[model samples]
Target: MIEIVARNGSPEAMLCPAFICDACRKQVMEAGNVIYAVRYPDQSERETSPLFVAHKGACDMAVQQWLAANYPVADGWSDLWDEIDDFLAYLGGNFKRSFAEDADGQYVPHVVVMPATSPKLP
Candidate 1:
């Protein structure tokens, strides 16, 4: 679903599950390559969200032209540099799966063998 987010009293486009720029019809992989465009919602009663992602260098002209033809107000559209790999650090931990060599020389799940003297065993 497309959601329009407002930042600093200005509308920002938030494209979810879609990296394609709506303005230039190109993929927006890096966050630093985004130019947000805000306009009035097409629906009157229903709330709408930002639905476009334009490239910074390639879509600059296209975004500007679209904004000029659609929204003449200064606050209608804005550009922002975003971090593309911001979420890459979400899983920060030193965890590794225990594996054992199988007959085929392939890694397999390691079984924890406890001694009979251990209290964990019956």
Candidate 2:
């Protein structure tokens, strides 16, 4: 997975590997758990490793998502694992972006905002 550092909650590339993998896993302090996609430029498409499971109630949902990607549905989602509900609260709270395809077969969701803090900003 490609790790990005958010600028005021927006995504940015990780400067170095010094940061812990846990660092890559952002905590949704207020939002609960951020659910954003992260695309690894070099890594081939694959599901999240089962071994990385945590917060089973929440982690279970993560596992389900990883499984869905491994087995895709062209029409739409076939199965909504119970774990999914556990993660939805944080879907927009915190996110990681990537160019890799999700179950929908696209490079994750993203869009520009109206500039929060800027000098006559873009």
* Per-candidate alpha-carbon RMSD to the true structure: 25.5, 15.7
lDDT winner: 1
Per residue, candidate 1 scores C-alpha lDDT tens digits across 1-122 of 12343334336555345455545454566552333333333333222123334555546556545534443456343333333343223212212322352354554222222212211111
TM-score per candidate: 0.34, 0.19
Question: Local distance difference test, per candidate?
Answer: 0.39, 0.33
Candidate 1 weakest ten by summed lDDT: 113-122
Q: Per-residue lDDT of 1-122 in model 2, one digit per residue for the tens?
A: 12344434336544432111222253323222222322222345422221121233444365446534643355232433222235544444436633363455555333322212211101
RMSD of 2: 15.7
Candidate 2 has an lDDT of: 0.33
Clashes of each: 3, 5
